[model samples]
Target: MNFHPSHPLQAFWNLAAAPIQAMALEQALEHRLFTLLAQPATAASVAQQLGLNAASTAVWLDLLWSMDLLVRHVPAGKAEPGYAASPLAARFFVDASPENCAQSWQYRARSLARFAMQWCTLLREGFEPDGRTKEGAAASTGSWAQAAREQIGQEQRVVTAPAVLHLMDALPPLPRQGRFLDLGGGPGHVAIALARRLPGWRGTVCDQSETAEVAQDNIRAAGLSDSLEAMGRDLSHEAIGGGCDLIWCSSVLHFLHDPQAALSKMFEALKPGGLLLLAHAELADDPVLAARVMPFYAGVMLRGNHLPQPGEVAGMMARAGFAGIHALGRIDFPMAPVWVHMGRRP
Candidate 1:
């Protein structure tokens, strides 16, 4: 007997999905449990109301039961247990629940499902110049400003922008510090965070003119302008100036139609051995559960930017001719996971 040695390159293995499970779940979500949980109903009553044949309805119920999507409960003075939406579904699946993020995320999920269904055609037809986006779909529903107007938004901590790498705490202090450049910085959240950690560092937050105005106001509000500041630059087409030590590209790439090109430009702006920190939206640790949550953002990326994967990110940095690459911490704050990748110019 003989065994093969490992290949010197990445392996591309085919994934065989159990479509039966997915189909069962989809059917239950759409038909039986969708309205049945409006009030307690037996499987037979649900089937009758939804027009599902007894056999098919039984199969759907069984699948939900096995998956813990529904619980069988015995009503008082009743012999058989009546079926009801499981605890998980009651809180999350019910559309009327105020706790449901479905409205905020429904657009995302629908977009992904449409794309995944046509992925084969997409690969073959290639992408249009604007990008491979679905028509009529908009990115993130609205701009950050629109969100702020609706949700007391001003400039609050959604989360860290350019996440600090572990090396920040481990590496020896540097002899000279350059100006920090934060692209797509909102309300100076990143600059303030960085200033707190590095007193000697001066920073700039560059964004659209309107956003820049907001960010500048936020920087002054924090009294960090003694060290950090803000600027307005359209990074999509403009050449950003230099004299920067570390450039923070947080949550910007997912909105970039050409992330690699932007990364190259970022690399060009850095001095030798200067750092380029990047943060982008990522999937959760549980791949299956995240399948429902993360891919929705793909629509937002498709319509607006390209949310690159970790491997794609590393490859982009490499193509930018950066070195000393590092992986930093992740943000999985019950909403979505954001990946942090960084590198240094040689």
Candidate 2:
């Protein structure tokens, strides 16, 4: 009998070691290591500048190089190779980069790390619903408002705004002058982008009151106060104004207690033949792809929110009486791949 080692456990081992890699990157980010490596420098030089142990710094730099976050190159007349930020790191991790997302990245990393610690307890005894409804609402609003003020804007400017623009370019052109609605638009970055792209169109961003205030401030700052407005309304229960020519909603439905109802509301809000573009991450059929999505949303799921499966949102759209429903493929979002689904109100 030929003996074959069952599937190697390297994948599991890698999973076990994943936290170490994350910590390495976190430490580097905290130390502004990538910014320091914006220009190539020998590890000894890096150590001298950063006040780190030379030998340990060399090993750390090598690890980052292996991770492809840094590149090693030999400078003219130099025996020792120097490490610099890789293109990827330079674009996103370096503080001087226009599209830098290092702070937002760290915020998310810390959030997810905290969430990860709750998994065991959450699994054993499911999350308890907040009984104090008023307090919960206030807390939730404050958290979202804070995110709108800080983290969400960075993500939108760096990742989401460009993705939305690219996705819009692929679709059929809308009217030059029409009413547009951005549901759950935090800080109004997406709304601002769309407003700039369609100067003739008037836009409204709907979010929680505090968040909408943040969006309003952003709209004013962008000089779009004349054409763009933010509406503070609880979308799950309140009315979203009707006669919208286009509605752009992303990563929002899962947070609602009744997504189906929300879809119906969105359908009602649209004018006949209006377009609805919804972008959200659904649990994929492929294990690897699903793995990419699930961890980020696990807390949402544990908190009794619904994370849609593939085709699920489309089916909901169909039931909501949408016509010309179609999947627009996946957009590589900041943390995960989000499927864009389009439907027309007929």
Candidate 3:
């Protein structure tokens, strides 16, 4: 079955194939295949060392190699070829790499796989599995918050503070000693990075109570106590503290129950001429690519969260009394492209 959206019938068939691909990769991760394949070795050798069947190991290696997770080399005068981890696997699949995302994949495999089972029910019921009644909503909220904490490390590593810093560098100059607020910022990584770049700058990371705890730990670990702080506040219902020269809201608005209200609050929270940077994913720009590999995010959208179009966000900024509004679409993060909406309070 073709996972590519090139054919209509194949598209439907892909529904079955996508999860199979994810499961294969996750199973490989569990077996530490990538680590073993850091140096090229015959599949039989791998199987013998890992205590597995040689035939099955060879077939698995060939499958992963076809999927670009491995590379095979046939040595001259040797009867068997050796398999090695691909660059992608070495970088992201290996458990010991600094950029390893095995934990994130593991989380998805364990936690999100449950949601996939309810796709038909979600479509038929027109409500999330955990979003039926008030009690259900509360439970779902708690689950989401806990998920946020669990995924923060992975998210922080993937999206990266350096990436945010790069985005800031492309923009107009930021003020020195700026008062900044990282609204909905999990782990305060971006704020700490930005604060370091702009000397004497202090920023606060505001998020849900549980998420704030995670951010606090990150802040302490970074030794940024003097400049970065985490506040436990719900941005959807609460106003971010005022007097900020710059306010960064990353991957946040779409999840709020009322994005317009939050945007309005952000406008009020910013000082005159202060900049507000809204960073989020915009999948419509490349639907084919998104459909191919971003199935997990599709589930996220199904759960009442959203990824607003750039035009929609610009209109919201205009309505909120923000001027000089503009957007930089398709800012490449490690995992996906993010659209950035920048506006200045008049």
Q: Judging by TM-score against the true structure, name the best candidate.
A: 2
What is each predicted model's overall lDDT from 0 to 1? 0.65, 0.91, 0.79
- Cα deviation of 220, candidate 1, in Å: 1.3
Residues 115-142 of candidate 1 have per-residue lDDT tens digits of 8897677567644545526542334323
Candidate No. with top lDDT? 2
State the lDDT at 19 in candidate 3: 74
How do the residues 278-327 of candidate 3 rate in per-residue lDDT, one tens digit apiece? 88766665677565336646665776777675388889889999999988
Worst 10 residues of 3 by lDDT: 291-300
lDDT score of model 1? Answer: 0.65
lDDT of 3: 0.79
Q: Summarize candidate 2's per-residue lDDT along 4-96 as a digit string, tens digits.
A: 755689789888988878887898998999888877899999999989999988998888888899999887898999999999999988888
Q: Rank candidates by lDDT, best first.
A: 2, 3, 1
Error of 2 at 310 (Å): 1.9
Q: How many residue pairs clash in each candidate?
A: 0, 0, 0
Residue pairs with backbone atoms closer than 3 Å in model 2 (clashes): none
